[model samples]
Target: MKQAVIFAGASVQPEQQPPVPAADLYVCADAGVKLAQALGVVPDWIVGDFDSLGSVPEGENVEPFSPMKDDTDILLAAKYALSKGCRRLVFYGALGGRLDHTVANLQMLRFLADHGAQGVLVDHAHWVTLQRGGTAVYPRRDGMYFSLFAMTEQCEDVTLEGVAYPLCHGKFSNAFPLGVSNEILAENAVVTVGRGDLLVVYARD
Candidate 1:
């Protein structure tokens, strides 16, 4: 499965500027093109309306979508990546600025996960995702915290390991904040969910 990295035009912290080499297919969403270029990584494909791309890059592989289109720029980029056989997408600069856009991007993860694709939203302080029924592991980083929120009705049979507080077959709901502020203990921490959708967020203090 080919991996695709997408850059979105959101407020990014300085620590998040340098491009990380995790995906072969790189995509820039509108203004994200400039951000990627500034990071010294030219995108293999640039997709979005021209509104944010201010100045275009002189090259092929740059496809422009209608500015007045129904889909958002980030969604367009994700769709294009999927069309190009990308199985996993790592989105950078997806958080910050408008709360509406941040929530929209979070919902997009559900779409990707439902369609047999794995999508992760990366920002300066958080890593967010909708964990369906699977096990997710995070390599330990000192002073980092991990959180899990059940976005749906209930996340049943959830388990957590290598954390300050552990759970065994626990059920979580959107109305409750039971899974907040858990710290990583071991070299790696594991989270497993049996049913419902969960939004797992990892952050550093």
Candidate 2:
């Protein structure tokens, strides 16, 4: 499986830019082309409605969409990457801007998950993703916090291990943030969800 790195239009400080990962494909969505230029990465594909970008970019790979379309720019980029056979996607500038766009990007994680692909939103201080009904392993990071929340109404038979507060066969609901701000105590922390979905976050303090 190949990997794709997508640049989104969300605002991120210079200090908040994470190290760009190597990818088989690089995508820029709308104003994300600016971020890509700042990061010194030339995009393999550029796509968007050109609203945030102000105008269509000059490139043969640039794909333009109708501004009235339902999909967000980042969504269009993600779909383009998927069509190119990239299974693992890493998105930069996908969070921290308008609240609605941030929420919509989170839903994109679910969209990737449902399609048997892995997608993550990353910034300098955090990594966020969604997990379906399955087990996931996370390695401990010094001075970082691990948190999770039920994306569905409830996540059943959720088990957590190697964390500051561990749980076994527990139920987590979206109404309460029971899994917030936990520390990883072991080399690897494990999370298992028997049903529903989880929004997992790893944040730097």
Candidate 2, run of 10 with poorest lDDT: 9-18
Clash numbers, per candidate: 0, 0
Q: What TM-score against the true fold does each predicted structure earn?
A: 0.92, 0.97
Report the C-alpha lDDT of model 1 over 1-205, residue by residue, as the tens digit: 8999998888676456434766879999888886786677778898888686676666788887777888889999999999888989998878885799899998898889878888888766777777888788877766568888988889999999988899999999989999999988988888899998889887776
Cα distance off (Å), candidate 2, residue 123: 0.5
* Candidate 1 ranges with C-alpha deviation above 4 Å: 55-58
RMSD after Cα superposition, model 2: 1.0
Superposed by TM-score, candidate 1 places the C-alpha of residue 120 at a distance from the truth, in angstroms, of: 1.3
Against the reference, the lDDT scores of all candidates come to 0.84, 0.93
Q: Pick the candidate with the highest lDDT.
A: 2
Q: Which candidate is the best by TM-score?
A: 2
User: 1-205 in candidate 2: lDDT tens per residue?
Assistant: 8999999988897565978989999999999999999899999999999999899999799999999998999999999999999999999999888999999998899999877889999988889988898899999988789999999999999999999999999999999999999989999999999998999999986
Q: Report the C-alpha displacement of residue 85, candidate 1, in angstroms.
A: 1.4
Q: Would you list the clashing residue pairs of candidate 2?
A: none
